[model samples]
Target chain A: MEKVIAGKPITVNEEGYLTDFNQWDEKVGEAIAAENHLSLTPRHWDVIKYLQNEQKNQVALSIRRVGKSGVVDIKELYSLFPNAPLKTATKIAGIPKPASCI
Target chain B: MKNLVILGAGTAGTMMANHLHHHLKTPEWNISIIDERDKHYYQPGFLFLPFDIYTPDDIIKTVEEFIPKEVSLIKSKIDKIVPEENKVQLTDGKQLDYDVLIIATGAKIATEETPGMEGEEWQKSVFDFYTFDGALALRNKLRDWTGGKLVVHITEMPIKCPVAPLEFAFLADSFFKNKNMRDKVEITYVTPLSGAFTKPKATEALTHLLDEKNIRIESDFAIEQVDNEKKEIIDYGGRAIPFDILVTVPTNKGDELIERSGMGDDLNYVPTNKATLQSKVYPNIFVLGDASDIPASKAGSVAHFEAEILTDNILHFVKGEPLTEAFDGHANCFIETGNDKALLIDFNYTHEPVEGSFPFPGIGPLRLLKESRMNHMGKLAFRWIYWNVLLKGTHIPFVSANMSDSGKHYEKALNE
Candidate 1:
């Protein structure tokens, strides 16, 4: 189904993850973060940018990798998005859901 | 010349197929394994599902991919087992005659057994992580759910992966803390046991971890029913604990077919000689995995260890030789403690988890009953090993099926 985020039709899978990466922007990220009851901080954006860059390179993201990424450590990443750091972070970053995530 | 039929193509059944195929000569022994489903699940991955550490594809694979090509893979639901006649009846009215039978049909979460557990609040407010569907549903639920009272509970003991509830509590603490809602979410670790775990030493260590995380421990809580309207879990003692969201490990019971076959105990688990893994009533039938009523944790590690012994015993039984090898109920598990750390516990029927180094004793590497980052790495690496090695019946080096006391700290307990 499609969700209208800031008047832009964004497609999502059955699990409510983004289907199209192109449809995501700062406004869409804000909307997604709001749904998860999170207000993305600068730290969260750093993790989001790291995830988006890694996704473009088709690299798998894990807690250990994120911790060593130089952008943000695992502890700080977890603090930024508590529910599920990699999952929630990727969702708001407008990347396709990581296959490693169930 | 003879037939060996194994029911349920799960962890034990799949391994047995690969192991026995190599051990038993083909054409002389017709080996067949049966199950209703085509997919095999990496059950331990269920714990990581709700946490989004593992995806659905990471945990599931086709059963045929694991079963040896030499072994006959029968895709059909079992109707009954006629032990006296050495025949198993299928749902399609097909009766398969066997010289020997192995029951590996594992246990499942019995949610309906608890009153009001599967009521209107099921999958809405209350959920289970024991099943693939339940795990996926919980993933969705936790995705948008804000901070509140999160209860990680177990309805009874002897459930599969007994430490998973504790792992969930630990991971939830880390998860909520990462979300910056640690204060908003009041986490509770509830169980039917008197302490945090079944074993005393492990319980002491685990309870301390629970304390450190500010997760309340509600021990010895035997839930009578779930009052979904009020979102309260009422115990047998009339104590009620309210929760905004409940993640439960429901009562675990063997396949219903075991009940219908009249070959199982009260919980539908087969009554087998604990050491031999052979059925007490019928000599030709053997039991392994969660299907057997053994005093071992129903984890994949136990099944892997049992499979090694049962394979040797089956060959002895076929040759009319005495079954010599005994299964010591060795169970090895890595408990995820959150924050990129986990604890490794290795114990058996005769030994309790102690503080020491594993494999090499005091030399180094994985620590027993102690939390460490290496242990967490081991936990993550196990998923790869499970898929590539364990199911293929390959022996993991240095790790024997029996518990080793070498290099372990046993002074205090042994002196007593």
Candidate 2:
């Protein structure tokens, strides 16, 4: 199967990323987004999952802030936040209701 | 028996070498400059080289070509600095004693500080533009490659020329469009800073430029390591950024020699008096440029201003008098925006970049707090002046060592 992402030659064996962490880049998360038609919310599960695993890249940049560039979240953007937003928030504040949407 | 020996003949050392040559009375005072290499580079020009604006020949020249005849030039690597004995040992096993010493043996790029950054992706897929070789390598890659994910990442903070990465992103947009490969290429700028830049005003201005170019910005990315096997840069939180090409600014640290001498801070930078360029531990030792832990901007223009004030302070120090010359962190850089336009901002230690007219208040050949084609042209013109005027310690008209408030329309500015 041709990988959605470009296959890097740095891997140890013929398999996937079970070897080391240094081989990771934002392109892996981008492959997941590309499978869908650029949908950032529900279709962005792979992005958030990878972000939650990393923890350092959590701050959300404002789209309206600069107004010059529109950057797609090509990395693990979901877990980079404090928690996912209420629309995508894993845990809802003040109440414990299993909201099926998130 | 008083002699001043400076280590490293880079921007800071060369400026001080010229400044001292002019200020100090000859024969009575002897100044010597030392570095391992013979060539001196105009560091600012490295950013423009990838775009075919500057040639490699335009940026390099022998260190001795700039040094005045009166100031002695020694080409040798420093083995270690013996601060307690007031002597420095050279790599050739020769020890040179100094009555007064200056440390300008600036910062170095340690990509090894991060995991996998220097691995298989280095230069082949990942690149750096800080060095001549790095810039040249990227230039060759950009020349032929069709395009894919172009990630411009800053691994950590306190890097040399912080804005160059953003400039690269802007220039790449202009470059790819010219090549008719804009659609094939996706450009993203990643940094540890909260916004597009360190200062909020400049960040706001720069962030706006990123949007205009359709370039993406990823902020607060503290790289834990480069996941080479996955072909990604993974964070501590497990976030990953995969790159078709990674142009990274690795973590900058003071020279390793400083660390060996046991005279530097958490980084290899020496503890310095921010106002006066004197070493905190030793009275006779002075530090400048990226070698010191000064809060000033780490650019060639900053070294130019610091050299002006430091010459006077060093004179006072020798006479056993109090140091009077105060180094105002006076600095300004012409921010190059693509499409033949640039922006200029003037600020100091206390002052943040404010929007107003520069040098001249209402009427200006150059505009302040805004971007103009004229400002962009000025950025290009500075290369000529840097070679002819700045290194020789000849003062440019209106660019005082101390930043002035007269021209800026501060009435519109909020009262401090």
lDDT of 2 by residue, B1-416 (tens): 46889998998898899888776656678888899888888888889887787899999988899888988899888989999999999989998999889999988788987889899778898888999899999988988998899998987667777677888888889889988999999998887655788665667778888998999988756676887777788764466888888889987889988988999866678998878999999999999988887877777777788888888899899889999759988778888877888888887786667777666776667777688998888888898898898888888898788888866755534343
For candidate 2, what is the lDDT?
Answer: 0.74
Docking quality (DockQ) of candidate 2: 0.04
Could you tell me the lDDT of residue B127 within candidate 2? 88
Candidate 1 lDDT over A1-102, as tens digits, reads 898886788898766788888888999999989999999888888889889999999776655457668998655665688635677788899887654210
User: Where does model 2 exceed 4 Å of error?
Assistant: A1-102, B409-416
Compose the digit string of candidate 2's lDDT tens values, residues A1-102.
Answer: 123243553332232221333544545434433433343454344434433332334322221111112222423333433222222222111111111100
DockQ of each: 0.01, 0.04
Q: lDDT tens string, model 1, B168-192?
A: 9999889878888899999988886
Per-residue error (Å), model 1, residue B404: 0.9
